[model samples]
Target: MLAESRFVDLLAQVLPPLEFKLYHLKTHLKKCRKLVFTSKSDKSVDAYATHFFVLSLDGIDLLGLEVYIYESREYTTMFVSKADTTGHYPSDKPPTQMGKVVQQLLRGLIRYYLPLDKPVRVCLFAKAERQYLFLGSAKNPLKHVLSDAQLVKWWASCLDGLKSEFSSIKKCALQIPGASEAAVKSYLPSNPQLPWTVGDIFWEGAPDDPTIAVKRIPRFPDDPKLRFLEFLVAEKRVKKVSRAQFWIELQSRQEFRLGTTVGIFGLEGTVDKHESLEGNHSITQKEARLLREVTLEGDYSTKSSAEYSSNEFASRVPSYAEIDVKGTLTTPVVKRTVETPQVNVLSAGLVRKKQKTQR
Candidate 1:
């Protein structure tokens, strides 16, 4: 029953600068058919999806986020992926600002999306294990690898507003081997938690938070073995456990599975309109990774237009050259819709005299 069509306006008004990017993201989501309209479902939750948001400045990469959104009614829940592919942006070793980007997004989400005094609920295991700089989320400039406790404490500090007395997010649990309350609190400064609990934290919400609340599930190590790939390579064996396995066992019994399992990564979008719908979920490990280079053969636009992928679009137009963030986004599907920040398709063709040459 979520009117997700208007959800675009929520973020647009919330983040004015990224208006064009948001439009494209929405368009692509619709084109790929990743969005679902779920009225028939008897469960509280329905669809699950993931998105990778990359922030860049004038062709220079800033940061990247891989978020799991669990879609539901009350409010959607988001889980951060702690795998090898995310978090690293600009370079391999990102600064404390790495955490800052995540913090800023959380601030926006909690501020606008949640009811007052309701803590921003995050799904996933905050085991807080130290990890090296991933091409994403590998390491921070502060420490090459942030220990699990350090990571959680760092995240807690994200919600601790400068003017607030205590952190917005208070309770935390340790799913450690020999987790002690004193040991966990020892790692955290200011004792943000009144009584820091132990073991994994769980909330009812979506795995991929699409602005709506739904049941949440683990996101990282999404690659499957015989299990759900819960444990990492240099980490514990899980002793061989998967969240999907748990759901299977539960559904096998006369119990609820909460949210239905969906694939993380690009598994959802990989399906083409022409492909057979039969047994879509069966193929998990191998999918066509290489996209066929777009051929302009027999294309009406390509044949008729001279402006197709032309630098004239960028060089001739001031608005296209500069990303001018204009106008505020109004509620109820925008009272005044803002202009998009245009990007010229053929900028790489132009050669500049300022290009670095022999010294």
Candidate 2:
């Protein structure tokens, strides 16, 4: 059919040829013959004739099978078939179905080439999707034999899942401390190789939270006599230091002998310099009790001193006061008086008089 030819062409482009070998059918038949009979006769030959016939027929079929095996510099792969050479003999009809023919070929191959004592690694190539279905051993076989369409669907689903996981990881990496988008992008492969592994999906430090405490032992100890006192003072002043500084200080201070064992004080337990007390000095129980009492008393004294200083500063500032004004509040009132002449009372239009008064 034209459709079949086109499908085969597509397979040729997508799925390259694989490598495989015949099960050496003749030698296995000879071995079987030797085991079955002590003597040979014409009837024995006739009775065993069909087995020989099948062997010869399968040998030709195996040659046709060789066309699918591909070889390259990297590795070899095989394209397994449950059909005949012409791709027509293994019809989906009664008594001559593809499943029966494939089973017969598989049994023959297993019995001859694959010995129970030594396991054979069988790799099958699904042509339609160009994906591999690996079989560890012949004893435990694939549960569901998939058709070409089913294989494509399965491959697509796997790819979708992988993409989703990659996106989630990338998003999470952006939220982690010291992880940059550029760095993640650079570390991730642009085009992943086939037959991927877990290492391909995750990088170093992706699983660890940077905030968690990491316990570390001193690698190289510092000189005992030269830097011991300084190391102790620094350790007392600072709660935490770099791993290198911690190791150096620890080695220097641990050298002093109290009695028989080396006198080791400070820097024993978890050292989180950022969160813990400065110089995280490790002291005996008696010393710790004394230090606690002194700290409490010092805190109380400091609080009292601060309050007294604040009150004294407030008293020193000038206070608000009312002052008396000197000048008069009201202006003096002025009065004016007018006077008329005595003769003007008898005459209607003759006399006039002017007068002025001031207070």
Candidate 3:
């Protein structure tokens, strides 16, 4: 994982478990390059498998960007690093806010990390509030003060790189008045969406089947795992307090099979059957909640605390899975019927007498 702190925090805030269906980080299969940002200092970037490009220098993460491919197209989620602390009461390293440093990271990302042949899109909600992006005091002009559209425009310009032919970029301006704003109104200029964008080709557009809209997990170009989970309150009226969202933390050991009810997560009270050898029983609400809670916190230790997990010791769904971690497809477990063996009869013992004469 990338060692950068701010970028990681940004991902957590934007893609909360309840709101989005998350998937495990798998080895990225696409052909790409690892970025090396060399300006004030020389740094080696770690292509952290899955959708992250983490640039580390001397063991400390300098920059982190969440990137992914959808139908051969690359989507750049966010580019972030530790907040700049150049002004009074500054930290050890605070050059991330520097104009030159920010340019190097963005320019290098597209020129190196991303594939050259395919189209790329940057789709993310950039936050307006930042302590470092502004001047700490009136006299300080070293810092580049910016907010909202101004900030985005600066980033877009940095991304354009050289402005040459074969590699030109067209940025869609954000619809905000008076530069940056806390809330975004909307994004315009409608464009055509890809086929898989809707859902699975097989079940997509099926009105009766609501699950058709979900994408699957283990999202290699042609991965076979078709397992996904769904969470519902299952009540007519749900109280705000009780209406909690559920998420499944993807893991290497976990194997999901469609329609196969696995063990419960952490149900409040349950002394009933855990799970039979043949998973044919239906899962109760309590049992589902157990799975929900456990999945939320992938490895929540009983005694020790964790930064991310403890921050929220809890972290989904029925339907085809969609990979929202960055953007891809998700899968759900599917059920298969097994055939029983044919039984042999003894009452037909008369056949045994005839077989002896064949020799």
Candidate 4:
């Protein structure tokens, strides 16, 4: 665990400045020529033409899953050691373990983003041959689910085959574009056997909490920098925003189109007290997408008050305005905890006791 944490810390160091822009790429069609080719082999499968289809009951637009990729050169690297207690590095040893864990988890993430009906192209610029090879085993099982014995044998075969493969491999040439050398090294396994898990990269004692160890990669004197490389790799350029940076960007480019009305067809907020009122307050992005006109309902706070003040306090409503989504709201609004709101709500007796103390 210590080693794993350290690896993640090092990874935090090497990734370049990453940023993502929402491109409605799906709406923009590309023009391409159709071609026919003859093959002699019995299994002459056209890999490019081969596609799989995935069906989902949920009305999620698969087109929205598409992301725009851009090449960037600005990046820096650092090492995070477990020995540094005050630092963000994991509290473990042989930090390479953390990389294995992260790679394992990333496999699932890649699988998630992949179109179920199509083979997704992963353009991995191998920065470290050994590291990429070690991580490559992780991709096999993801490509095809196999028995435990087969997995073990498959891993063993890679080791046996390494000598022949590495004969032509040059360490110097094994470079990943736009990432730091140290970052590439951090992905390697400590031993020949690569052990990985989806959950292993999470920081000990702070599972689910985003902050673990974050080392700022210093910029070069001449480079024109944009977003950090690590942020781009993690797909968090928008979601895992630092509070400080959000405020800075919020000051600029502030206009947002509502895309739909607050409550016409599908726009409605769930009333906290009354089902009817609660329904009025809750609206979904999907709902907003369907709206031709957007009318600002009353302030969420005022609605919150009005809903609770009404006799139908038994039902709790969720407000769309209170929701946090990337590229939607200018300022973040904290909603009532999704976990039972009653946990935070004070009882009349406790409220009186607090009031008495204040008096």
Give the root-mean-square deviation of each candidate in angstroms.
Answer: 17.4, 51.5, 27.4, 25.7
**Candidate 2 lDDT (Cα, whole model)?**
0.21
Candidate 2 lDDT over 65-88, as tens digits, reads 111112222111122321212111
Model 1 per-residue lDDT tens digits across residues 125-181: 333223211122223232234444455555445434311322333334432323344
Against the hidden true structure, what lDDT does model 3 obtain? 0.25
Structural RMSD, model 3: 27.4
**Candidate 3: stretches off by over 4 Å:** 1-27, 30-64, 73-99, 130-146, 160-174, 177-359
User: In model 1, which regions exceed 4 Å deviation?
Assistant: 1-45, 49-51, 73-75, 82-96, 112-120, 126-143, 147-149, 159-174, 191-195, 203-359
| Better structure of 2 and 3 per lDDT | 3
Winner by lDDT: 1
- Residues 1-359 of candidate 4 have per-residue lDDT tens digits of 22112112322332222211111101111111111111224232221110111100111100011111111121001101000000111112111122222232223223222223222222111111111101122222111222222322222222222222111211111111222446433333334332222111212233334432221212111111112323433765643444334323422321111221000000001111111112222233233222201111111122232233221211122222221112211233233222311111000000011111000
Cand. 2 TM to true fold: 0.18
Assess candidate 3 and give its TM-score to the true structure.
Answer: 0.27
lDDT of 3 by residue, 1-359 (tens): 22222123233332212222222222333333322112234233222222323222222222223333332322222223212211221132212223333344333333334444444443322222223111222122222234434443433343333232223333323322221223322221123121112111112233244331122111221111212222111432112111011112221213323321111100001111111222112233343333333323332222122223322322222221112222121223122212321110000000111111100
Worst 10 residues of 2 by lDDT: 342-351
Worst 10 residues of 3 by lDDT: 344-353
